[model samples]
Target: MFDKIKNIFKSDKEENNVTHKNAPKEVTVPAHKIGPKSQDDTTTYVIIGASIAGVTAVKTLRELDKGAKIIVISKDENIYSRCMLHHLISGHRTIEGINFVDGDFMEKQNATWIKKATVKEIDPNNKKIKYEKDGKEEELAYDKLLITSGANAFVPPVKNLREAKNVYPLRNIEDAIGIKEQAKYAKNIVIMGAGLVGMDALAGLVEIDGIGNLSLIASEDRILDKQLDVKAAKAYEDKFGQKGVKIYKNRMASEVLIDEDGKVKGINLGNDEIIDCDLLVVSTGVRSNIGLVEGSGIETEKGIKINEKGETNKPDIYAAGDVTGTGIWPLATKQAEVAATNMAGGEAVIEDRFEFKNTMNFLGIPTVSVGFITPPDDTYDILTYTDGDNYKMAVIKDDVLIGFIAQGDISYVGPYTQLVKEKIKVDNLAERVFELGYSDFFKIKEDGQFEW
Candidate 1:
């Protein structure tokens, strides 16, 4: 499947060459002006959500079809990177500072942004969407619709977990603000689930002053089990331990203990252990926001289904980003661009579907994991290089590098990612896998461009 996807990206170069043929001619327009639909504005592109995917789609559509109307509908008032919410909680960045785009992005794109609006339903049959803004409901028509509604944090079905107050999930900017506010007065803070988001929550509060006992509960044997091996995870576990962060591994929160005021007081573990918790941050996982397309005749399994062109089952409707469950930031951006190009009558397809890639920087320790962390069976050969705090590991199957992990020093992440994504064979390399660099694959073209 991955080889096929990569081949598509290589072959699509020809398709991209003809994109401008179908694309509308460039038109100069005044900045900060979103005029009424003109006679030439035959296509109205309505996008849902305002994060990476929706925002990228807006920019791509405008660049492809200058005269097309672009409307962005989002429940979030401010457009900020959800990935950087931890920075906001740690006071490393403000709400405005976390924005991934420029301050005048909407104005520059000549797009209409409808903020703080709740989408009620998507009427594919009528080519309209019913959404609620302020106190009234309104409907918006569109020639093409892109759903980048993203995902919502999932809270487990622990007893009293839903009804308890002072419990938050670190998924949105609002959640970050609430967590930061509560952390100020929290006596004992417990973060449930030790995945990426759970670790992010820990990273945000680890340095805060006056916070009482900080604890992390993970159902897996070690933290970040999906992203790192036991040894790699132990490096971070040791760092968190040194910082007085209590970690309970192989445990699950069976119930939420509440105080008299319905605020979280403690949590009961599945093994009958109880831990005090003034504030609880749930980061188990996330589920796509597919409610709008529930009855809109769009096929969905786990998330909104889309073809290579980012088209849903329904015509003129597309889905991208977390709504399609491609949670990776880079993949979401690529999917949005593909959807936008197709919507603007250009030719494009989602080419890269490799998802097992993640980078982490916690406690000042940088790490990058690409492909699989563990081999499927004993047929794979594993190589390792370690020097002091720096560690690098490579998994090879049939001479082809299948997975890689770099911890402490991740300078070779780019080459490692390329090698992994392209399924390059490393058996011929005279140098060790850890010594791999860009020079190994560097090719200087006549145009002074470096190709790998």
Candidate 2:
């Protein structure tokens, strides 16, 4: 891990000048205490999404200056960790264990929280939000509104799907809880899609007792294709098979077999393959929610179009996290902090580009990938290794390192991502790189340091 960060700093061979590393310093947010700092400003910042970005945003704003009013509104309490849902599904950790936060945590930060409101609409020009809770319609006005309303689960369209019983999507707290309740009645579990959540769900399933058979199906040829190269993905899929997890690739679930009254009996694949399963869990994909921005005057594309600073088209209004449709959570979360800071009268920014990669446990495969992007054509130099059970690979492009993948006995994900995010070129040659190692220079920073 230390070596990887060293590579990032040493690989500063880019054409443009990037900021040098800054020393660790204290960060003070304004939302902690209301004050008359810049303008006639008794601004109320309403932020949605409470998982990561929302919590980070509220805390960030409070720490920036603590002079602003922050109201955090979400459909649920700040307890669920979406990242850990797969583990919950696998039975490695219970839903109660992963969800640690609640209303009290926010109160300690001097912020007001609306725990059970579902945002219905946004009157962008009027600077107001419409929501519903307990059968009551409520409208809240804000001086500064931060829309961090996150993404939603992508439900797949399969025949007899609704008729099938015990169908679950591993996402929010409610979903995990539902799956847990249903897991007891079923022996076999079929998790659709071999993506991160599906793989993690399988990992979670292995830890649970009374789970007779677990089948993982991939519509694509490999798992985590969006985040890893073919070879790396293959290695992990092989690992899944070795773990006694059934692997079905290059096929889509076409029809869900249901009982007479309608409950999942089994699922039929595209190739006329029928697999029996007592329960079905889907982790197909995720789509950003743009309803809050619709007709709200915020620039709407595939995602909410925010300026480089995460500001929506309207003044004093910013949107971040999944709703911004930025496609990157870290960037979205960082943008939330930046937007919150700037909203509270501080210096903050958002960049136009960022690296897209994720490295979590892929079916218990010690794997990580960053910028492991295979360009349109075979144009870059690729270096890979697989000595016995160990595997490692580095990608260099245009005389600069562009991406790399590390697995089993490899620990350089931090440096690899930082290097890709910065697009830094190494002073050492590719040979020297694998030899000298990244720890010689790169640095590892925490999530909210305002680097990159």
TM-scores, one per candidate: 0.88, 0.83
Query: What is the Cα-based TM-score of model 1?
Result: 0.88
Q: What's the lDDT of the predicted structure labeled candidate 1?
A: 0.81
Tens-digit lDDT track of model 1 for 230-319: 888999999999999999999999899998999999999977789999999999999999988877788999899999999999999999
How much lDDT does each candidate structure score? 0.81, 0.69
Best TM-score among the predictions, by candidate number: 1
Q: What overall lDDT, based on C-alpha atoms, would model 2 receive against the true structure?
A: 0.69
Minimal lDDT window, size 10, model 2: 16-25
Instruction: Give lDDT: candidate 1, residue 245.
Output: 96
Summarize candidate 2's per-residue lDDT along 197-250 as a digit string, tens digits: 777677777667776687888887777766667787877777767767788888
